[model samples]
Target chain A: MTIAAMQGIVKRYGNELALDYVDLSIHEGEIIGLLGPNGAGKTTLIHTLLGMIPFDKGSIQLFGRTEKVFSHENKQKMGLVTQELTVFEDLTAKENLEFFAGVYGLKGEERKKRVEEALAFVGLSSNAGKTPAKFSGGMKRRLNIACALTHHPKFLIMDEPTVGIDPQSRNHILETVEKLREQGTTILYTTHYMEEVQTIASRVVIVDQGQIITEGTVNELIANIQHEEKINIDVSTPGDVPVERLKGLEGVKNVHVDGSTVQIISTVGSGNLDRVLSLVKETSGVVGIQAEKPDLEDVFLTLTGKQLRDGEEE
Target chain B: MTIFTFALKRIFKDKTNLIFLTLFPVAAIFLPEPEYWPLLPYGYHYFGVLILFVGIRLTGLLVEDRQKGVVKRLAAAPVTHFQYLFQNLLAFSVIVIAQCIFMIAGGVIYDHELHEPLLLLILFIVFSFTAIALSLAWNSLYRNKETSFLVFMCVIIIMALLGGIMMPIEMLPDVLEQLAVIFPTYWLAEGMEWVVMGEDTADFLLINGVLLLYTLLFLIIGSIRRMG
Candidate 1:
């Protein structure tokens, strides 16, 4: 059964549209990556779907029932780690979990067992008594997740769970998320980090200007977009060479020379790198040359025609 | 019972809050300086009133869950809004009722006849429920808990003093007394005094009526804020 279906969702704050006729659906046991630059209606979509905020016009169905039927039982099936560090800082890690367990009406020995499992799941069993004030930034994030996970939700929604965290913690969290998905928890992960989406998400939804611009599986999205392969030449310095000289190479779709970096967009990934490297010797300052694959950023740029989204609040 | 479990857990874990919610009110009853000292068998009435009456503004602390995002998160769980508010009321009411009972015991230990235990309990409920309304009403406007808490405390402190939390209600000028009477805490304190001292049963009924009406008005207003 489909887990969630939100159709033609329209939400407004005063005159500014927070969500503009947005349509999205989540299937059972699938990880959907909500991708957008800031203010791209990602938070609005999550909040609306969770029934935290009411929309101006739209219909929401969860578990094949209307939003009203999404009762405590339905709500129990989902866990959320919000975009901010909101866990109580003064309480110990165990205390935090107990409260959440209580939130789900889990009590007595049943709650104690669940709390222990959740603490261990987040790798925080050793620090169960530690308060957020004494913990590092990563620990706080994990505690927040543990609070959400004590209920063993079927679906999880995390907003930018890895932003500003150290590489080690980020990798650990990403791995934990993968493990959750493996255990059959459908996931909706939102972030501006392309590598994060590439690593964990099966499907990518790109939102822009309060609407879903396009969405598909990661590979399908990559296949649909035609990005000019950008060949980067690390040179000692750029020269006054004719820009057309590089353009003359086979498969070279466009050429732009900026300072010590030589950027050439090639139409075909094959033979272009080789031809570019062979001609690199002609430039005296060419130090290193590399050709890279197109990523979500490229697909987004190609689809929206804007390098950065205008996510400023009205 | 649901709110009780949740609130009980919260109160048990919180150490800093012990002073603000409990010990401080008890300490207010006795003082090293006579100037700041709380009222006796007489002011115990205001004490009961202040204990629960401040609940009007203090309820802001609980409703603040939404603005702080805690309420929204908590709401998503197996709990209802009524359960949430009920738990919030439980957390403070336990403290207020305990303090009242403790004071009554103290009065008995001193061999001063405890005038009306049931009436005092009723007065304390009126006090606490009114505070609940004030808190719920203000929560919709303030997004941050600390700011809302500070504002609520300051406003309530001023109102409590003017309403006779510190002084005898009869000492005030007739005009000021009437003005202060409008504040639920004043009527609550006056009603409690009547309960504990065995006088003004008529005034007690008026205060109880005002307290019920005030609590209802706030509950209605707070429900509106919660809806938004």
Candidate 2:
């Protein structure tokens, strides 16, 4: 069953196009990882889906209902864990959950039970009385998720939930998301981390330049790429090797050089590694050599001609 | 539990806000009045000044919530925009009424006699509504909490000075006195004066009607901004 569908989404800021005719469909009980670089319209798409910002043209359907304006009932069926810490610093963990639950009209024993359950799910029950002001970065992130979980929405939209936290907390959040998936909750997770998508996403959607460039399961995306093998070689004397000579080797599709290291991409069954090594040995001494199957990062680099974290430093 | 109750509970949980809201008015009752303010009742006049303080504090609370993303978080929940704003307004109204009650108690503790206690109570209630509406309207005009708070303080101080909360309106220069009527604080203070002097029902109703009009106008603008 389709949980939420966005068809032909086009969003613009003045004259700049933020989203250009984008389409996304989320299925029931599936974790769809929305992978993109900075300013790739990932946040814009999430905001549009949540009805935080209006799009120039699009139709959104959630829980099998399409509406011109999202009703409060529709909003209640969806939960958003924003990237920023949205929990109140003055309010304790339990109080924050209670406040959000009350906003959803949960009352009496139901509110208390849900708040307690959410706290326990996030592993913050011991610090339920503590305010977020004194919490570490990881604890605050967990509490942020717990606040969203108090209402128990059908579709959970997490925008980089593990952006800046300790390894333990990140793993805990990932496990919690997996548990939610087991409980039959549809999720749309957005992040720039390819490893995260590789680990938890049932399907991967790569968005770039305001549109989805490609999308599939991790293996499917990797298999769909032209190059099947990535080879890395470190040389003691890179200046001795000729770039044209390496490219001329049989089945060597692309070559990239960075100081003393050389990266070679090739198609499977190419038998290019032996020829390339023989050619390199004649000119320069090889320090190290590695050959492996392509991952999502290699696939993204091949498609976009840039690293996923490029321009993120700015 | 409705959003109103939730928000009110949150506000009460903040010990600083509770102390400021309750204690400020109580402290104002102890300030010695200047003899130059003979045209207005000093006790109610001081209470009127506290009303502006409540307005500033209430506006600050709403603006801080917006800055902290609490409003956006609530918007994503089962609550509608109208429900959110209405609850916030209702909560602030309750706070204003509590402040008024504290001011009344302060007046009694000081052995001050009000000529028309019932009329004074009615005027305070209307004034509370006006403050809530005005605060909401003002809050929608600025996005930054600090900027909104600075503006609120400036407006309240200027209004209190011109509206006779600081001194009698009759003591102002003719031009300043004429310009004072443009402020809602003037109407509030002028209405309270009428209640203190046992003015006719027609006069009392007219003043209350003007304050109500300000409340309605502000509520309309605030609601429009909120919807936008």
Candidate 3:
């Protein structure tokens, strides 16, 4: 079942178009990655879906019904884990989840069981009674997600959930989301990290300027790109046949020389290493070689002509 | 259990509120015991306004929620707007009552004053609810705290003058008194005065009922505007 849908949604803020006629939908079991640059209306779209903001045009539906703009029943069926630490900093993790559970009208044994389940799912059980101030950023975010899920909403909206955390916490959060998806929850996930979408999102939607440019599976996204092979080689002999002969190799696209490194792009995943290696051996140079498959980041860069991280693309 | 208890526990965590709750009302009692107290006319109304100020400080709790980004999260959560507003009202009313009790107790202990506890309780509940509703109203309209505080002070001053807090309705010109009839503060102060000076339970009841009605009105309006 399609859990949520947005059609021709338009949002404006004082002459600025926050979201312009954007169309997207998520299924009951698929985790859709809403990828975008900053100022790209990802948060705005999430806010609109949550009925926290007004849109100038279009329609949104949740669970086959027209959206009620934050109605009781609708809110009860949805969960939000925002980027910022929305959990009460003063309240312990358990207290925060308990408070949210109470707000959802959960009571007595039911609320306690849910809180325990959520805390355990988020791997925050040990930190249950600890205040957010004493917890790390990653732990707090996990608690935030746990609090949001205290009522067990079927649809989840996570906006940049892993903005800045240590590697270990990011890995933990990603793993937890995978577990949630395996349980049949639909997720509208947004992030600047390309690798995150690779592991969890079944498909990726690239949003920019209040609209979706294109969306597809990772393999489909990178399918049409010319250079599938990137070869980074460190050479010793140095200047012989140097750069020109390397670019001339069969299936080799381009070669650039910098200091002690020669970078080569191979057309397709043609195992361009062998031919390049032969040429290098004849030229009395290349020593080290490493080839890697193009991950989603390369695909994203190839499709958008923009880098994932804020401004390092150029 | 109840969200109210959770809110009470949350409010108590601040600790500063507990200190202020006691100090505010006691200080109000001590400020004017005799000649020095009489130096300012209608001192009771000033204390009432001070009580409202205490209420406004409690409203700053919303500021903390905003600062922490909890408001947005709550807005997105499964809880309805009614639940959120009620939670705030529950918390706000608890703190206000805490302060009001200290003031009333100081009246009994130091001033040797005694009136109807039921009347006073009704009046205090109304006052606290109104104060919180007004604060939420200001917060919804103006995101800035200073602006809301300014508007609060202006309203409280206007209320102090028109409602007979500083000057009784009988002393005011007929036209101004008629104008005072429209302000919530007038009702708030009138109810409080009835609780203090009048022994007739009906007068106290009448005044307290009006304030309670105002409290409900503001609470509904503010909650609707904010949550809706």
Candidate 4:
């Protein structure tokens, strides 16, 4: 079932358009990754969906009912984990959960039970009495997710919840997200990390310039791109390799060399591996050669004409 | 727990706030009288500035919330923005009222004579609303907490000097005296003067009413301006 849908959404700040004719939807039990570069209207879209900011023109439907704005009751069914750490630094881990849970109208034994469950969910049960001031970046991020989880909303909106943290914590959050989906919680997760979308998102939505540029499953997006194959050739001396001759190959679309590694993007049935290897063999010693499928980064670059990290095409 | 309780708890947890809460009231009781300001006792006159600092310190938490993105998160939650602002204001007011009580109790302990204790309490409470509302409005104009706080502290000190809390308003130049009336501190000093002289009750109430008007004006301005 459709959990939430935004249609023809237009949001503007003063004269600058933040969200321009954006339409997106979330489904039940699915983790929808909202991927975009900096200032791509991802956070603006979330704010508009939650009615935290007004949209110039749009319609929103929540729980299968169209409304001009979600009511207080409707909001109670949704949870938001903001990109920045929003948990109280002065309050203890458990008090933080209890305060947010209480705001959601969870009371008495239910509130207590949910707080404990959330703490355990984030693997912070032992540090429940400790304040967030002493938590490491990863633990704080976990507590941040736990605070949002206390009320147990059916739909959760996590806006770059794992932006800056240790890999262990990032993995823990990803695992937690997967677990939440297994329990039938629908999620709309936004992030700049394409690999994160690849790791867990059931469906991916790519946004650029305040619009939904393209979206699909990871494999489907990779398949839809013009270049279907990626070749990584490691050489002892990459500088001596004939980059121009490789680019001159009939099926090769792009060539990027970094350090001793040369990456080549080519058509799916290029049949140029032998000739390409011969040319490289003439100049430099080949350490390794691997033929692989294009990933989301390639797909994002192919469609958006920009890299994910720095938004540069090459 | 309600936002009110959580806000109060956060304030209490801050050790810096404890120093301001406890030390100032005791100091207000023992401070020497201002020789220039004979209309009201020195301690009573200076207590106005102490409460102003307390009010701004409390509202600084709201500024912290805005800077930290907690306010934006609250905006996404089930609670309304008005509830967040109102509950926080209520909590700050409760702290200010407690400060008033401490000042009153200090008066009793130190034998610092008060012409009318209850009237002074009412005046302090009303002035506190104006101070808190002013701080709120001031905070909305800036996004950086440190810059906003430092600039406001300087402004408050200037206001206290010109509004008759430091010296008699009558001794100021005519032009400065006319401009002094623009500040809420001026009305606070006026109210204290009425309480000390056992003046007409209506006049004392009028000064408080003016302070309330300033409070209302500042509250409206603060509510309209969005913080970071």
Per-model tally of clashing residue pairs = 7, 0, 1, 0
lDDT of 3 by residue, A180-285 (tens): 8888778889998888888788989988777787788877777755445777777776566457877777777788776667778877856667778877767757
Candidate 3 residue runs with Cα over 4 Å from true position: A66-71, A227-230, A238-265, A269-272, A282-285, A292-305, A311-314, B26-47, B94-111, B115-121, B141-221, B224-228
Best by DockQ: 4
Highest lDDT model number: 4
**TM-scores for chain B, in order?**
0.75, 0.88, 0.79, 0.95
Query: How do the residues B1-228 of candidate 2 rate in per-residue lDDT, one tens digit apiece?
Result: 376776677778777677667676667666565455534346567666567656656666666677776776666676767877787788888888877777766766676665666677788888878877887788888777678767788888888899877767888999999999988888887886686564488988988999999999998887776422
- Best candidate (score: TM-score): 4
All candidates: interface RMSD? 2.5, 1.7, 1.7, 0.7
Residues A236-270, candidate 4, lDDT per residue (tens digit)?
A: 88889898999999899889898998888888888
**Runs with alpha carbons beyond 4 Å of true place in candidate 1:** A232-265, A269-288, A308-314, B1-3, B20-22, B25-64, B138-141, B196-203
Instruction: Give the DockQ-based CAPRI class for model 1.
Output: acceptable
Please provide, for model 4 over B1-228, each residue's C-alpha lDDT reduced to its tens digit, 9 standing for 90 to 100: 378989999999999889888887777788865554556557778888887888778888888888888888888788877898999999999989988988877786777667788888999999999999999988888777678888988988989989988878888999999999999999988888788775588898789999999999999988885536
- Docking class for candidate 4: medium
Q: Write the per-residue lDDT of candidate 1 for residues A1-314, one digit (tens) a residue.
A: 68898899999989999899999999987889998888888988898888877799989988788846558888888788887775766568998888888787688899899999999988999999888889888888888888899888988899888877898889889988988998899999998887899898888999887899999988788878855577778776477444677789888888777777778888754466766765665653578777777678778878877653344332
Better of 1 and 2 by lDDT: 2
DockQ of each: 0.46, 0.60, 0.61, 0.68
True lDDT of residue A248, candidate 1: 90
Residue-wise lDDT of candidate 2 within A82-105, one digit each (tens)? 888888787789998998887776
Question: Each candidate's TM vs. the true structure?
Answer: 0.85, 0.87, 0.81, 0.89
